[model samples]
Target chain A: MSRSARSFAVAGAVLLAFTGLASADAVKLGRPALPEEIKAWDIDVRPDGLGLPEGQGSVSQGEELFQNNCAACHGEFGEGVGRWPVLAGGQGTLTSERPEKTIGSFWPDTSTVFDYVHRAMPFGAAQTLQPDEVYAIVAYLLYLNDVVPDDYVLTKENFPTVALPNRPNFYDDDRETTEKAFWKATPCMKDCKPKVEITSHAAVLDVTPDAGKEGDKPAGAVE
Target chain B: MNQMKPGSRVDRRRFLTLAGLAGACAAVGVQPAAAEATPDPDIVNLPPWTQALGAGVNNHPYGVPSPFEKDVVRREVTWLTASSESSVSFTPLYALDGIITPNGLCFVRHHGGEAEIDPTRHRFMIHGLVDKPLVFTMEDIKRMPGRTNRVYFLECAANSGMEWRGAQLNGCQYTHGMIHNVVYTGVPLRAFLEAAGVKPKGKWVLAEGADASAMTRSIPLEKAMDDCLVAWAMNGEALRPEQGYPLRLVVPGWEGNMWIKWLRRIEVGDQPWGQREETSKYTDLLADGRSRRFTFIMDAKSVVTSPSPQAPLHARGPNVISGVAWSGRGTVTRVDVTLDGGKNWTTARIEGPALPRSMTRFYLDVDWNGEELLLQSRAMDDTGYVQPTKAELRAVRGVNSIYHNNGIQTWLVRSNGEAENVEVS
Candidate 1:
């Protein structure tokens, strides 16, 4: 039995002893999951190409798809529109004041682009792209980032070979080793700090919208 | 906001000293305002509520808050996101009391946008490294073995994301509102994975949602086996449409985004998927250029809700200053309130159940002298991790990463009873 179930069983046993009435509320349920339903929903692709569906598409085909579906939110060259994520470029800019993390710059594996595009590209319309279309759009994104040649065509075989420039930049979490000091048995209480000066204010930055502006009422007024 | 009349500040001492006949007037019947206000002849007859019979039951099939509470709704800062569809609305923290956030008052955060998923057509699938690949309909899943009632706080990794740079938001609603606590009714995810029989080599489980973003995150197998749950009902009723009606993953103590809404797929895998959320968006950029990936656990945090910018004090005598304190790692054992900034700290009274990974309400009823005060709350959890200051946090993490900011927030209360968001030394 799982830990949660084991705990529940103990609680039930205790309750049964107390009442002595024998409540038969326990009922086992749920049927085995179907294979066809699994196939339809299991669309994730790992870095080792574990879940990449069989597909092939050229850069040219992906370019057309990008313009038709993606360009409205992601700019013509994958610069990003409004606050939608930027897909390409931002190479060698990780150390800059404002790092523009994009496919060519920060992402490590090629499968992320493939899996993300296949399942959730074009914003509002997700999971609409076919396996082949996903391959094409990913290939076109690579072309935009200068990761591929104009004649390049991505396939399930070649997808594993394409790696990002910033692949070596990421590392596993090291909070236990790096932030041990944060774990304190007893923190300073009285006069912990002699004086705490005022450093900044929200009004100074002017990022927050004015609080009492009744002009723009909520769309669905509960009242 | 029933402060004594202008000249009554002096009379306040007299009332305290005398315990006088005015107490009789209060004994008869009097709202606080009636204690002092000079009654007008036209209005002294009867108030609207006293004059007429109130509306009957079923006036609202599902009831709403009083019309007087119209302003107590979730609000979004216009500058936070590009569009409302792919945006977030903060919970009205200042206007709330206690730790339990009502389903309607809970905050909303979406990526590609809020989706209206029909449960009839919705299906949840578990595939990849498993002995038996499985799929479940809403009904199929609800019939599972156990329905555990667990209360956990779901805080977005970016709960106070804006503050990493500085005190950029005015209210606690905006500053620390990307969170909610609730009782979940569902089976443990390990039970379903066990039924399917996870392969020995399955090191990770990539959970995917069905929204426009199809939000996905890779949970390590150990963590998945530990506390993760596939919950359907939140706070008793069916999950709100805004909260992924049919199903959602309840990852206790982890960042909110990982608790995938409209949950549809869970694929057991041998390695981390390195999805976009873990890499591009949620990753933390260090001062030296290296970025920390998969920084999932939300650190210990707390905030003073009342006497905040939106809910300022009008009455200065005896008042209850309350707020919430929580830790992703464990239960909050103690919460300290600092009336004079960080100089002096006193342990506040913790109220309600102190459950693991759940919010605990703390309060300190104080006699406000109506002086300029710097208010702050510091929380310490079972893990012995005390909530750090904004300075200490910034010194280590720097101001680059806009996530996982569990620093102490300070609210400046002026003599005139208005509070503004501010930072301290």
Candidate 2:
């Protein structure tokens, strides 16, 4: 018999055996999650300040925390160091050739800053920061971005009030309407263009890694 | 008939001369007039492997690729990121064939690096708006009903981000290697969600990783129930450590960032948790200063793998152009090939099975007369989406949108049998 036919036969046998027991609903295998377990892992914060913990932190405290924990990669003033993410100061360069998408300039929500810092910040050592420390770091980041005064004390009450400048510019994906012209059912198949000219060459840039020399040791070989 | 020893110096000299002549004849498609005078040494002489016994059945408990394929590997451009821990490596696409990318050779993208987790101690928790917040051990999940297997392609949104402005990467492996197709064995995410009993108000689900980054993304509950898989094995083996060994979320037909590796938690909520990846990084910024958010699906795209910069054409006459085409929305129904720029096009044969949301291999055989040619491929998916040119993509998205660059790639092949990545007008 063919492979499909054999698979069909096996499936029929299994179906016949499980006809009475099989149900579409849950089998209920795992145990109920305890309240403490739920609290420990459910750390995501929404834009409406839903998951923010009750805490207060000042810019001065944030400045110290930022320097100690984040300055190595994000820089002292959040300027970024060596391809690391710049957290501040790219206010109006989005339309330019090089748009520096910093948290202050391009980010859409402040909860994202607090949630990310609390959940995954400080790079190698994550989830080690206390709630107050995350709040302080977020405050310092706001100060660096000129969104708050140096003496501003950020609290869960005022977290929702601090909005990002770029929030209004973000919209849902509009590719279907915006790029409808390019979705030709029968695209040009003959003489689409009169002549073709070479505009750019990757050889001229010469940025590709030398695979021949690194064949023995693969690139990005983790330690 | 001086009875020369097989391993003697005279025998070696005679073997080399005859091998060189045989190679020359094969290159020009000619047969040696006096076949007996110069017997092919490769066939006449026995190599060491033929004379000696090979290793036993269990020589290597886990087999690896042959040493001759050492060049086939994942590669990274060091300058692209701050550290290797939070970086990406490209799959060697030029050296690969068929739809299924080998598990060892699949490209890896990590946020806080690979995590080595003891499966016995690992736990997956589902909480928030579920009727019964539940936590399951590895064994508990394995015992769940409705286990399934599926094939899908995971592609990074920033696969061709570097070429948004112009051709920057010389090889397809660097330019378009941030993708891999594999069969995943797991239980449908809906099965777990149903067991937990999702609350009526739960509109979205936040999937979080257990890695140091704890990478998180908010996925629509509709999509979660549609085809998502809480996958544990890939290509019929326990997942690689770099690929989230214990468990990972499989968000089919979506950007790879949503497929959280080292998956440990899922929190159902009414609203999207605007995390750092969704707000600041993955969002596409247009030339008009506005940005497009939640752009998840990767459009149809294809690339000529062989005859690329790394795998250059080595001989003249009949040559087979091989490539891969895929779509996040649906199956790649057709792929078209263009030789002399876009002046003319021909339909390439779609080889192998054309599964939905899976890579489709394509080939086009042609006779080359030693002339310069600009090669390109266009993919059309079941969703009626056609791969756009770079110029067309730029006119709408602009160069600032660093992600979702599914523009058609062009490779210029010269008369000398070498190829280079190039953009044409």
Candidate 3:
């Protein structure tokens, strides 16, 4: 068949389907996602504690797990490795020149610790452990932050009870006060600010069109 | 090219910035790790200027930006807000290239907190106004045939949130670093919604993340059908943990909050959910004291990365001033570079291929006379919108808020070739 004829035929079928059979036939096309399949990948632990898993672990178990899995990057005490995020030491430093913002000091919720650990911790190897391991890791994180007792065990059952240290520090902004102060009028029309004038120009690179310039020497060659 | 006499201050600063190269000269014995197009630096072995190795084996399933790129990372000032956690961090949009922002270098902002989730037993349930009320597993979703798109860019409404008041930060990394672009692979939301069977009246959807806070947002169903994606991979790999590994919602050209990470569930609804993220946060304020609720799209914006405050002007002669520009409304058409503040604008040579909703590189070839000059860039999108200046933005949005500031940025280049963030009135 000619290309235009094929296109016409396909268009007719699409129009027919859209007008009559589109809604009815659409239901049968895709299969229902299985529960087990869902369970295998549904790892979220919501702020309202809707998806907490069934296993449990104590602070001691958590500490052991953290040391085994998280300490290298987060720091042994969650001080955070190098530029890695500091998790434990930023207690009450929110107002200082440099705030610490550790889990104990800055995090607004206890569940975030649990959620982050179970989903993405131990960096290179994700989704390798059981639910209990995640709980234990959370407990250990809490213990390190002094948010929970050393002997405390974190379980799905009591997960929501653990409160983060900086819980009350969070607030919502409607930005009403800010809008009146900014972003409300038609922007400037005339001679705005000092008119930007170009004094000189430089070519940083010559990557375009592969210009064989003298200074465009490839990196790593002997000078 | 203009030649400078010896012992000039401009030459001195260039020497200091390249002081590390002195070690490279000494370590000529150092072997290039990989022989790509460019001889790759021994990035893996060198100590990052910032991060140390994280604790435990759990340091990072996906590693972060290298230390040398530390100067290219996010920056936030305390005076920008009361608490650092509540304030914003800008991405070094000017310094990065290609579409992918390494997981470590991706900018992060949170209202409640960052959630940790284990993906092995993860689940996603679709209820509320759905015909089948189905649930999906990660394996199931992955098994289903999905599409991979090499589109780029995801930005926060508050990316330049601080620039509205003034050029508070000293670098382009801070003023315009909140945006990033990358190709992603995932199931299309339209396909997922079709499979789940939306009800006759389903008009909006609420996406929720699994982290402890369960971050949630409501998105229009039409927008979902338009181009929304449930992403599982970024730059051809599994999602970075910090970037919502396992699963996330990708709403291109929209505010970052709607692109939910650590995505947990999607509830079909006939009306907007009015969640905390949408109502209390992410909304824009107007000049008359009325808040602009549901301001979904981002405006056109650009920044000159090189010769920027943090990157600095290395020498006075010939300098290549480069940076990135993008718009959520559409593609960037042109970028104007101004050396005397915002006076006479020169059309910058837009390099690299431009893509819709992706970062476009712009370059200006200029020779410096070793005198003080104000550096600035204004981006124009395909839709014919020019990037607004700081005062223009303040006239419309007011200054009390800290979000959606897409104003033109200024860098003060001193006689010594040092650049600092400055507001030009």
Instruction: State which candidate has the highest TM-score.
Output: 2
Against the true structure, whose DockQ is highest? 2
lDDT of 2 by residue, B1-425 (tens): 11111111225456555445444433543344785568779889999899999989898899988889999999998878889999999999999999999999899999898999999988999888899988999998887777889999999999988898798888999999999999999988898889889999999999999998999999999999999999899999999999998999999889999999999999999999999888888899999999999999888999999889999887654467899999998999989888877877888889999999999999986545556789999999987899999999999988888899999999999867789999999
lDDT of 1 by residue, B1-425 (tens): 31221121334565453333333322322245666878786777777778899889889999988899999989887655667777888888899887788999899988777778889998888778898776778897876766688999999888888777677788999999999988999878887788778899999999999888888999999999899999999999899989987899999999998999999888998888878788777888777667788888888899999889888888555567889999988999999888778887878888889899999998886656566788999999998889988888877777777778899999999877789999888
> Model 3's CAPRI class?
incorrect
DockQ sort, best first: 2, 1, 3
- Give one digit per residue, the lDDT tens place, for model 3 in B22-62: 33333322334565446337654565644675567657775
Docking class of 1: acceptable
| Model 2: chain A TM-score against the true structure | 0.85
Candidate 3: DockQ? 0.05
Query: Per-residue error at B88 for model 1, in Å?
Result: 1.2
Q: Which of candidates 2 and 3 reaches a greater TM-score?
A: 2
State the DockQ of every prediction.
Answer: 0.35, 0.46, 0.05
lDDT of each: 0.81, 0.87, 0.66
Weakest ten-residue segment in model 2 chain B by summed lDDT: B1-10
A1-223 in candidate 3: lDDT tens per residue?
9999999999998988756532322433434656674565445555567668888999887778888888887778887764555777666555443445466765556665665566555564556778899888888888887778888988888888888755564444433343333332333333555444432222232211112343332111000
Give stretches of model 3 more than 4 Å off.
Answer: A1-223, B1-90, B111-113
Q: Which stretches of candidate 2 lie over 4 Å from their true place?
A: A1-20, A211-223, B1-37
